[model samples]
Target: MNKENREVVRPDGTTIHYTVTGPADGPVMALVHGWGCDRRDFDAITGFLPRHLRVLAVDLAEHGDSRSTRDVWTMEEFARDVAAVLEAESVGSCVVIGHSLGGAVAVETGRLLPGVVTRIVALDALHYLSLFPAQDECAADALLHPFREDFAGAMRGMVEAGSPPGTDPALVDAYIEKMSAVRQPAGLSALEGLVSWDMDAALRETTQPIVVFAVRAIITQEAIDRYGDRVRIETIELGSHHFHVESPEATAALLAAEMSA
Candidate 1:
């Protein structure tokens, strides 16, 4: 399994970094990491995937090795970062897989490249009742107030909120530490972009079949009931919010199965 690291310059001058693996003509699988994380999160999963599947693991601008100076931090803009990579690689068709915030980006990517994207796979994404549903501008501001005021505390809160019962405290602390260290201003700004993103609007516009693999403990019944018709929700007992990292083999198998299906 040879992997090639590459970069694409977005129209806004931001550099989007990504890694390509597997065969050139194989079916494409675009993996997008969540907020505060990078393309490296998919390293283990990619290693476990089939050799015939072409994998494009992307680092959203300002995350991982990707660098950016643009002020616009919308999810759609992040999708453009991914679209740039696909265009550079000339990917005709792909299954976009995203985690957490990246799931929103995946939806936007599908909307942006409707003709190219075949399906959407979400790992512990799109089922948060408070986060996924459409919110009023005022409500969005209020939800982001704590993060704006105290970024560190907010990062810890996010890690803890995503951790299910029996999750190790060390793992939570590690994630908080790594996530809190995200490039200053951009890290905070990207978060603001995520909270302010209109997921309902994105879902309405993107008609791709979305398959959500949610952690059973963290997902609420309300979330499933609301988006059940639009999104296929599959509950799995896979660690915390970052279960893809905790259970890479299973996650890879799940994505492989989805791609084949």
Candidate 2:
């Protein structure tokens, strides 16, 4: 499959960057990366996908090559960034797959385009109780205080939290380095947007079938018990929160199976 790099100008004049592969007329699958990550995270996964499925891996504004001057950093705004790519391509229907923070963006995409989005797939996303569950104003502020005070330290802590036992220390360090370098205040602001987001409200509004592929080590039973009835929760022991990167072929297979089903 030939991969084509492209950009779409949003209504707000932000240039959203993305990569497309496989047949243009094939069924569309839009892959959204987690915070501090870009579309390249899905490069290996896209390579493993069936030739007939068109894959659009997007770099949300201020992430990767996508540039944005917009002030808003909410999940809904991020969803619109993805929506702009779909609209530019004239995509009729697509399965929106998001990783970590991207998972929240996927839900918002479903809500924004109920008729266009058929399904939502969350890769190690939406199951973190501390992050997903709605937080009170004070609680949210407290959780964000560390990041506000020391962004680099908070990012390192985040990488450590996602990494399980036996995970390579080098890999953890690499992730921390990459994530910590995210463009200026946008990275910090995006983190604030995610931690403060109302997951309950987003879930309430999005009616699409959501499948969560959670990392076994990090996912809490409490999270499953709470959202299992609302979303399909499947735990996988293949990798950590960044499982798709650790096990691309397996992750691609899961996505392919869902897309086919």
Q: Which candidate should be chosen as best, given TM-score against the real structure?
A: 2
lDDT of each: 0.91, 0.91
Cα displacement (angstroms), candidate 2, residue 113, comes to 0.2
* Alpha carbon deviation, residue 86, candidate 1 (Å): 0.4
Taking all chains together, each candidate's TM-score versus the true structure is 0.97, 0.98
Report how far off residue 236 is in candidate 1 (Å). 0.5
lDDT of 2 at 253: 94
The alpha-carbon RMSD values of the candidates against the true structure, listed in the order shown, are 1.1, 1.0
What TM-score, to 2 decimals, does candidate 1 have?
Answer: 0.97
The TM-score of predicted model 2 comes to: 0.98
Q: Candidate 1, after superposition: displacement of residue 241 in Å?
A: 0.1
The residue-by-residue lDDT of candidate 1 on 59-168, one tens digit each, is 99999999998999988899999999999999999999999989989999999999999999998888886666666788778778888889899889989999988887
Q: What is the lDDT of residue 149 in candidate 2?
A: 91
Q: What digit string (tens of lDDT, one per residue) describes model 2 on residues 1-261?
A: 899999998866589999999898999999999999999999999989999999999999999999988888988899999999999999999999999999999999999999999999999999987776667788788878998899899989999999999887888888899998899678888877887788888898888999999988998889988999889999898877788988899999999999998
